[model samples]
Target: MKSSHILLLLSLASTGAAAFELGAPKNNNTDNLVWTGHLSPDTDSVTSALIAAHIYGGTAVVPEGINPESQFVLDYCQIAAPKPLNDFSQKAVGLVDFNQKTQLHPTIDESSIVAIVDHHAIGGAPVNMTQVTPIDIRAWGSAATILADRAESLDIDLPAHLACTTLAGILSDTVVFQSSTTTEYDRYYAKELAKEAGIVDLKAFGQKMLEAKSDLSHISAAEILTMDYKNFSYGGKKVGIGVAETLTAQQLLDRRNEFVAAMISYKETQKLDHLFFAVIDTKNKRANLLWIDDIDAAIAAKAFTGQPKQGWLVLDGVTSRKRQIGPAIQGAIEGKK
Candidate 1:
């Protein structure tokens, strides 16, 4: 891209009112490098991209959406967020938070990826490969943990609020250290990052961050689903699972009809085979899995072995969807086939 177009793109990323949603513009330069997160970027996704960009000497760009808590941290730390990313064709790119092709921007050239740091499931197997260096995706709680390890090893001094911002990703992905995937490294890194961030109380800070993201007012049920959703393909079946964490499941239950209606519309529009959502009670450690019909409801029960009450499945001890829900659903589907 020319310097003039670069200036225009950067200006839009930083200045537009709805700049994040602009996707990516066309006919841009390819020589530039970008570290990008997944769609509806959470704390880990955003922080991982930012930290990786710094380490790899690239610009960290936002995905399609930003979690409310991440936005809060950016505002709190007075950090300027990189603009949202649209197309990745021709441009050098590094992916964080997710490696799945569906979660990536469609226009992105997977061959352009030089590195990927994620903790979720891999996309479909790579077809011929070239330079996919440092492709690290483990079963850890947070992708931030991976980058945090690097920073500590390098003894790098983080910018203001950078540590805290990255810590939020670890806390959120680990459900404040209550997730089944939480590792010893995650805890140790949290403390290390807390010291760098000048955080005195970890749990209190985590709770505050969760509360900041639990706000559902002025948001439709459809928005809630797409805000933090994931797409999966198992046995040639397309599955869309959206996990929306909240301190108050009751508030969401109040709009059961609205949720079901939205789910039906979304399923039709997206042409999905299995579409489901979970409203997690992060404070109490439970979930209410919502569905549009009986088949989907039955699949939920088979997936998590939870009993549905009033069109909602009450799932206990199920915090991380990566461990608990996705595998269960894939099992259910395979078992039927």
Candidate 2:
């Protein structure tokens, strides 16, 4: 490890961020480094990996298939999608968007993680990676925003494709700045990136991306449930939260029975104690929360303070799962004790 990396590790460790070492040594060869994001990656995760690899010297890879919005951004910007990476045996890895053990692939060598630029809480992260490497985890709305800001500060040139995708990432994660997670930095960078990408009408471009994200016409119920899902540990219980953003919420709500059945099967297969799915209407900025059974309905009622209507909880002005739903659910679970 470099002396600077050692100093950074020591500083992070003093803040109680260090955990047990996963026994992987630090690799200094930047050429061999690879950047990736969480499973079921959304637009921000996908774009952040590309941007990170561009600014840093490495290849960008995806843990799984890119979501629709991400694909739309890549195609629109004329950027090719990164290849998928299944094995992390000898690779020096950097993570974007998420920092959790549960979100990682089972085959990941925890010790090989040299960097993490994420906008989420550090849950079960192998913090000991800090002892041998540098990591960037902050409260920004999107990991893409973090990387974009870094590139800007360091005077790193962001090409047109990267700038466009970075802007798309910010829009997707912040829901066009409607999400509560949106910060001033996110807003500022979005505008700057828009100009750099030659997007004269930012809102129009964001609408296009959202429409692309809403096009789930040919996907199955099980695929929808896993599309933008995440695993969280709340109140000593394993919980799974899935969000499906669409322009036409009614179209998806019509398939409530199918989604419910799929949710139940997914819950059982993952052995999760609780599972919740929120179908978000981006236009109206609301969500139709679906429950699989009585237990899930009870939990939703407590978390959202809303009664179920025809087996769905109507959450008005609830778009951001990270900002609104997940925190509410976690609070409700903790409050029960």
Candidate 3:
């Protein structure tokens, strides 16, 4: 609860995000359910939606652009990222990876969000819980965990590739069981999923999957900026954070200027008050927090208690944004306020 952090948070508190609303007026797509994940969906988002679509018969809406690892996963599974969500004529909607209205597609009616499967903090409930036949939202390691569990409980037979992809989602979100948010249920389900998916060596396949997720070659700086990015309503302030899960932190540092410029442009374009881009070294289990302004660097320094070098905050053992970066930043903001 540093005074500077409090003052900083309070100064920007008035510019809060829209109030949380639960129900949207009923919409046209009540009979045809369309499912989607948050913007810039990663493995968990993509896989969870795939499973949901398979079981429930909804079209899985892909985000605007797909990342390399996500592309790799989709290709490996012999599937394609569903076409972008342009037409919203479907009757019902299901959200994955996130629950906030702001995180959904622009044209998607909140009333149409009849179901959801998410692992993040509950934003507003997009749909009335009582009205939705099945709503799965929990603070687990990954949304993949919830959906995979559901498939098993219901005795729904998932295709082999789908199982593998679901397992990939679990490994990615949990950082192969290294993240703090991981629970026993995550481990239990992961083991079951790995077996179901016909993965012989967990270590080998997990490493291969992680490697694929870390590949960012041939992608532009601007595209990289939004890769696995998410925005949060922190006490009314719009806080945006992005992550690059590369094999090594050095891979991003090599293009620091490009990354920084992209982030700055993205922040201004998105009208975000605060933005942070974390470069994760999955190989070494370390990270570097990059930001444009001094306040952001200072916040990262305090949040991770890491050393600030130039404009980047070097963290010794930081990886999971959900478990580490998100809470630390939120705490710094709230504690100071």
| lDDT winner, 1 or 3 | 1
Report the lDDT tens digits of candidate 2 across residue range 1-337: 0011111222343334333221222223564678898889899989999998887768999989988788889999999999998887778788888877768876678776767778886542333443345666667679888888778755789999899999999999998888878888888889999999999999999999989989897889899999999888777788899999999888888888999899889999999988999899888988889878778766777788665667788888888877789888887777841
TM-score to native of every candidate shown = 0.87, 0.89, 0.84
lDDT of 3: 0.72
Which order, best to worst by TM-score? 2, 1, 3
- lDDT agreement with native, every candidate: 0.74, 0.80, 0.72
Q: What's the true lDDT of residue 86 in model 3? A: 68
Give lDDT: candidate 3, residue 275. 93
Q: For model 3, what is the alpha-carbon lDDT of residue 46?
A: 81
Give candidate 1's root-mean-square deviation (CA, Å).
9.6
Error of 2 at 33 (Å): 1.1
Candidate 3, 208-250: lDDT as tens digits: 7778776676778788778888887766778888888877567
Q: Pick the candidate with the highest TM-score.
A: 2
